[model samples]
Target: MKNPIAERITDFIKNYHPFSELSYNQILQVANTCKVIYLDKNEILFKIHDEIHDSFYVVATGAIGLSITSDSDDVLIDKCDEGDVLGLRPFFAKDNYLMTAKAREETILYAIPIADFKPLALQTPAVLDFLLQSFASNTRNPYDKTHKGKLISENVIYDDHNNEIQYYQPISYSTDPITAAVNDIVQHVAQIMSNRRIGSIIVQENQLPIGIITDKDLRSKIATGLYPISVTLDQIMTTPVITVPENLSIAEAQMMMLKYNVGHLCVTKDGTNQSEITGVISEHDVVVSQANNPGVLLKKIKRAHNIVDLKLVRDKMTDLIQHSIDKNIPISHICSIIGELNNAITKRVIDFAIEKIGTPPPSKFVWLDLGSQGRKEQLLLTDQDSAIIFDDVATENHENTKHYFLHLAKIITKKLNKIGYEYCPADMMASNPFWCRSLSDWNSQIRKWIQNPGDKGILMTTIFFDYHCIYGDENLANALTETINNEIENNELFLAFLGIDALKNPPPLGFFRQFLVESDGEHKDTFDIKARALMPLIDAARILSLHMGINKNTNTSYRFAKLAEIEPQNALIYEACNEAFLELLKFRTEEGLRNNSNGRYLDLSNLSKLDKVKLKNDFQPISEIQEVIKNRFQLTYFT
Candidate 1:
């Protein structure tokens, strides 16, 4: 049934343009599906590149800021007050939002569903013209002078003494004169390449490029005698060539080559290889195009022999993180790249630490990364939380084995500290005897935690359960995970306790929809984003994954995705949780980068009205998930 509130919203919006042209019944139908959303000051309605909503918003009271983020700078594009329709362009363009809409003050919005309003738009020329004119002007309101003649998310050039980033420059490639038919013999192709003094040549079919044969291909295939000189060019050519349009940008070509692990790209009339050949751009071409890329950074990391060199590479990675965020890359993709790089750094540390310890490990031991590192969610430098579990030893060697690992852990942790990872304040490090133990000892401790479910046990479970073996014996980590999941499956009370713990931090929205900021202390009137916002999602995923017998997928997003697969009935809810967690992570990382601190406590006053609202809106999933946990675990019956 349509709410009575829709009728009131219909009365309100009918006075506005587009809506003004519609009849009472026509506007009422649009309002029937309208959602009335309340925004606390600084709440975000949508972000740049976010999927367009089925509905667009009209601010009934208060103000909204339509802004763009460039190089981490938030630029206000427009300040929308009463009767200002926001985010309507995405609906017309059938694309994601190009700018973010955030509440500038405590606001009430009538969200008119485009599914119903679209037909009305077609029927009314004035309404359509109003939208078309406003969109063409790059302004939300045609008559308003505050926003005009500039794109949302305008590209800002940055040039400093230390670094210069070129946004998008087209790649230059060698065009014409290098081509061979498929029937051309290998010897003939090689002779033609030598005559031209080029390293590669295109093999063609019809008038279009079909494949490429490079120096490496000839070396591996002909020099190694895998193919004879008499063989046709088709035999040695790398088929299904990677192609890009002639207008490919230097950055795009570089990233594409790195992503595909190719030394050369076939430039074609169209982007596909079936089109006529235009030119070829090689890896060397891409390298000459740019100096600061992940490829260069990764190469530096891999070649570094000392911790000092690694530290320099690590510093550059911080800049890369900022660049990635500023460019609006997908958070998931950034997380994977950063996580892989972090794992590489840690692996090198382990190798060096083992060498420094002066002896190969007495037995097989797995290095466990706890907390954020384990989940692959960490972006900025944080405390080290790790453990080591070795194979069980004979009674006589037990003490000695433990001592050996402890010494190695100390060296590794110290090196990591020097590289920017601080020591865990709680001593949750491998150097701690309690954490570095034999496989049997580790298994026993985990059993006790699940069997006895106390406050300490739950706390320990929260930290340790998200472990991933960054470097070491995978079987050992797998076995422990199996045992932990098995133990939890048989224990219903333990899941209930975990569920209760997950609800410890209620959704951070108050009765008036204001942020429930920290009342006092160093972060007075600040939002505890980590504790109040992030932890609830993390804790819920861990507990639910345990209950469902899903083991080893420690990432919050991954856990929710797995949950969605296991329980399709609740897939939408789980999927929402995944999206919320990622968005929150991005929010925290950006805040941290801006303040140069762990992005945990956000000063509520510093947020724009739209940002405040966006933060509050994310809390909806937390409340919904907590309710799911309460019902599933029957938590209402708990004391």
Candidate 2:
């Protein structure tokens, strides 16, 4: 017997995900069991710690607000409008409610029974996967025994400034950077550069960097007839000068240039445009900074003709990382050099891909590195995760534009695979259609995730939000980040949902304060250093940085340090998190080098007493930071 109300509810439920993945007959059958309920504004549907209901909910009309209790008030974490679903967490876990659901205004909801939905999901793989992803709050469950995120390794080099020891040491730059006024003619600036034997000149206004002109500019803009020699230097100069701090190391300087796709970096008093210029380092300056060092490796990467050349350079980089670890150089320093070298390889690969395609990109685009690579913490050769963001196109040209970029990404990813950065297991690479999108489309996609974060959306945001521009126009990445931060500003509740995910992993120790080793599996006695020790801190840093609107950095340690400065009251805890992360990172890198494995799982039998103590000490910070997050996001009611 078909009830009219149940039939009407079926029409609405059939449109959204998990439901959309189901057949019409299955949907109507589930809808027949739904219990429609109405509520006035500010009425409670469920409270935190309430017993799990047999039925999850879908909004039939009006809206529902989801919130977590904090101190004395309810903090809204997400809003469910018409057709949006809520209470799906019950489908995956037989636990109490972690949030309160109430009507924001007069609302109507169709409570869809999980008992009815679960059997259907089990029969339909697509439906099961959607529910699983949403329940887990990530692409896959982080704590799953089978899903140990590991990658195969071959090995990669970085020559230091003439010697490896001097690589990260502070670099020397020409303090007397040649400068010109905005009103100076290009011919006059070129004349000054020629007389001074300098290849570059900065254009200044009131002792502030406005732009820069170099020999390349002279050749491209004047000699090639792009601009007249008599035109002002401003007419030919590259604007928005990329600035670096006075203490930049050779590797750091090189990375900045690669990051911004520039040849020269203006060193300033305060490392910003608001400060006075102190010095400058050019591409030639970097190449000659060290004859047989990382600069050499960088030059080789830049000058490589094909994939084979890049592969050789990459193999050498592995030796460099091993040597750095053997020498006991700080893990942070090793990361800067290795991360930059990795970027150099990626930049060169992108260059080769473009050449191989036999055509230039239709418009500007940016290549974004996600996850560990985005954080510059990819010390070992692991899975490569990336995405592409191109400038928006017209409706008519969208498909063709997307097709062209997809072809380019396929070539780029294929070459990267040959070079030893194996394909990401989950296929989270630029080559995938979902990963490669126009800027406007990406914005829309991100906004959708931000608005309806739930569990799955939070997972996607955590992965994608910490993006670093590996190649192409950095402005595109910046524009995308700006949009993300802006949307987050309006939807403050997204961070609370993110916080819920952050608290998913509990303290790393067991009841007896022992190292919590795996009890059952192939590696039964081994410890998952990544999931238990590392991810807790990483998640805390990410949530805090987002809450504070710190979008400029992606590094875990760097984020913790920044949070420390901003909240001096919590400095000790923040500093502890940073130190623990670096120590743990160094330990993992060494383990990987020793075993020739991904270094994620560590056997307890191999650890020395001192090593065990050090590892245990680092675990304390995990508890401290989790408490900070629980209190900060008002997630006290959560755990």
Candidate 3:
């Protein structure tokens, strides 16, 4: 007898190829033997090593994940959604399934019998080729080592050997650097070098190499009185500057630096200095090209004099972050190194701004980083949130003091914007008069927020509480933090309100185990990774840390680690949360780098099976931690 659901099943299959290639009668015949299966979210349809099912399944609704489990470790391989097919193990020899197929969300699937479909696939060349292509593209069989298989060995994709070869291409050099005429006066040459900070100013005439005047040459000759300061550069400059071609490799550049015992190399259009000076490559540039060590990066940041120079350094920082993740470096060390570089960049911007202003600060003050920067966990370039708190001024001179600091902050932020640190969209920068205030005004504001603790007050508190002294008097920032801490200790209700705010997003998994993706807005159908995944963890960490009277730590991961130590019973859970947070952060950063956005919105359809599993694993701890918070604080009463 014909199955009643056969026509509907064929209709669904006919929409997707190579089923669409089949005649309607053929598709209907195949669908008659199909089984309709419903899977609850997370329910496993097939496990690793299980015998191949005779039927291949097509997703009719929701999503499915294919994963591999070995030695108690599970890795997701691929994900399939509506119209995507799974369970093709029967296509090959009678081998066991290489991966487990599971329902990512509550899913309805149509299982088409291989007996009915194989003859059609074999008869049609296009249909057979399409199936092969689909199998290869699917995330399943990631470990398959055969020719152009879906699963290449994991080592090839993620291990150090593969990443080193893939990410570290040879560095490029600038050719035909600007050169000075040999007979140029000593003072003029000195001015040029100081302006450009080029260690050696190439002396050329008619685009021919002549000599070079480096900082060393000036200090050794003119400064030491070996040669009069009024002498021409030709008198003191080293003759016959070493020249290289534009295509110098990092290895070759380093070799030249060693061979000549020189700090700078002049690159010409041709290999010889007879050609025009194209560019200069310094030893410092070579070092920056090689690695992102903190000492090396810090030195590079300090030497950056302009926005263009700083942007280059910032790009290197991104490379550093990717390298750290690829190498499996400790997250704590990565954060510290990145934090130091970020702080150094800001400090350089301030120093440059001060030089531009051509005046000393009117009074002492502290520059406060108000958000992730303050927390010291900002690995990616996100929004800039900062404020200025100047030293207390005389009542009559208060307005003048505030104005001076605001002007300074404006200059600094402008430079920062040029260097790729986007201005805070909400205008939460030091340039704002409300943010650039004297110490007394800041204190008053904190007091009001602490006493009131309304929605706006809570929002303000969240930003301000993370304040780290980026520049200026550390003591001033410390004093402010002490004041806020004292207020929080006094007002227990404020803690409750913070707790209420922390629980706003809750865990992302719904009762049916489906991801609570954003329903509307610019992020519609995409996961709000920040507010939904990362922020809840951050908020929970902050509230718990505050309740424990811990103020020294600001990073979410560190807070969880400290909490684990303080509360040993919940140590396992907190440690899990910390690990999950790091994984999620790394995932978000990689996604952001790929998509060229903030990495907050994730398209659920694009997640690989392995990525889906890792993400889902993260959710388990999130759900568990929220439960702990609920039980410990009795947060349900407030909610």
Candidate 4:
């Protein structure tokens, strides 16, 4: 007689790994002895230091959270969802469990008896190898080479084959740095560099780095007749060398190169120029370490002569974002790096646009990146929202001046779209007649929005208020920002209106912690992450930050952090909102990369239970912060 339950178990396990590697008859035999167990939400299956059980478990449905308890908190490092295997520690070792396993939601698991599977595993080479590899993966530190493959106190670090983890790993710079003294002949140093096939050599005195010389310096100073090759290194080498401490990660190294516009960095004992030089990181070395990384892509962006060239670079940036997200690099750091690249891309597009028109601007102007680009929070290539502010012109020349800038903006925006950034659907872009205005016109425009913020005014403030000058005339942009802030000071009602808007989208979670998903339309049954989760935090931050006259911090997370400092009584709430915003931003970026869309709408049913739990954990701050906004603005009675 056939045991239908055992046969069903074999069918499910066969679809997954290790079990998938086994023969059907073999799996059915192991499954016949298995027992089924069900758990309520947050129910613990096994815990740290608990005696090993006779059976290892497989997640049949829902999700399981595997975590390590430290002195401070429990860190959920890994999740096992449908078909995911856990509780394999008992099969590898007779020792107690090192990590705790708990059901993140209502869950059903299949407990496969070790006695029944061990004999089957020994007979199958594939199954035996799979067990050995899985057992070797449990460790406290994934990067630690010595402790690389052993169970340590039972927390597991999932192995990554894509080299994503290298983003944070310490870069291996050349410790035995080749150096030259200030008195060394330029010709002599050049000979040494060429002999070693290296691009740069440090200039030092008293064993401390003073300056550096690279191939560029030689070509310009010697070959171009700026200086003679017979001169001493002191007269030719670049002084005040850029210095960084040892163990700088690859991401940081790339950012440092971009920030300083240098091809090499000297590594000192201490992180300053005063310390002795220990190692050197050249552009060649960094490029070799991570091919197709930020340094390479940024260089490609700068050198691009055609629209197609920049498009290819933008596509590579997508790959970079994907890698950064996978490696779990701090979202803030990733934002800053990507923001710089985007800024560079936009600036290059503007340069090409100006050149295409074959003429310079009629007046000094500033290209403004409004909305997410302005906040430096744009990780994905979504819609572009921008504005333009040119210098005020004489009455007779106003129309002509505005026309020139508008044409320039049109060219820039079109090229941006051709590269990757989609044109904003609502036409809230710099090319619009309303957005392309003189500095004086913008001042008047912002004043009207602030002084009389009706529905239209309120909506405009949200779209246009956050501004970052990407190219040209920084002073023009600053003058406009000053006016917006000043007008906001006298308009308490505008703040109230903005506050009312902030509460429009309450925290997304409904009663019993179910996601409040869309009820109709093409996005029905999907969660509007942007509208329900991100906007509440963004709107509240914008209103509060403007009220406090905090002009420098435009990024939402930084705004909340600044709010925490100034409003100490509400520090905890503000701080939590900051963390919450970062988490949500990271979550959205991850989803966007996975589905190749904006990642604002999420299919609730497709998400694993553990992911839903993670998302819900971040929603609490949104509720508490909204309450703070409501009471402070007194919006309860405002009509």
lDDT of each: 0.79, 0.79, 0.76, 0.81
RMSD for each model, in Å, please?
18.8, 26.3, 22.5, 22.4
Error of 4 at 215 (Å): 29
Q: lDDT score of model 3? A: 0.76
lDDT of 2 at 388: 97
In model 3, where is the ten-residue run with the lowest total lDDT?
Answer: 155-164
Give the TM-scores of the predictions, in the order they appear. 0.59, 0.56, 0.57, 0.58
Error of 2 at 340 (Å): 0.4
- On residues 312-409, what C-alpha lDDT tens digit does candidate 3 reach at each position? 88888888777656655555556656776788899989998889889888889989887888887778788889999899978898888888888999
lDDT tens digits, residues 543-586, model 2?
89988888778889778978998999999999999999999998
The whole-model C-alpha lDDT of candidate 1 against the native structure comes to 0.79
Weakest ten-residue segment in model 4 by summed lDDT: 157-166
Q: Model 2: what TM-score?
A: 0.56
Q: Positional deviation of 628 in candidate 1, in angstroms?
A: 0.8
Candidate 2 weakest ten by summed lDDT: 148-157
Better candidate number, 2 or 4, judged by lDDT: 4
lDDT of 4 by residue, 493-578 (tens): 88899999888888788888888999999999998888999989999899889889987758887789889989999999998998
Kindly state the number of residue pairs that clash in model 3: 14
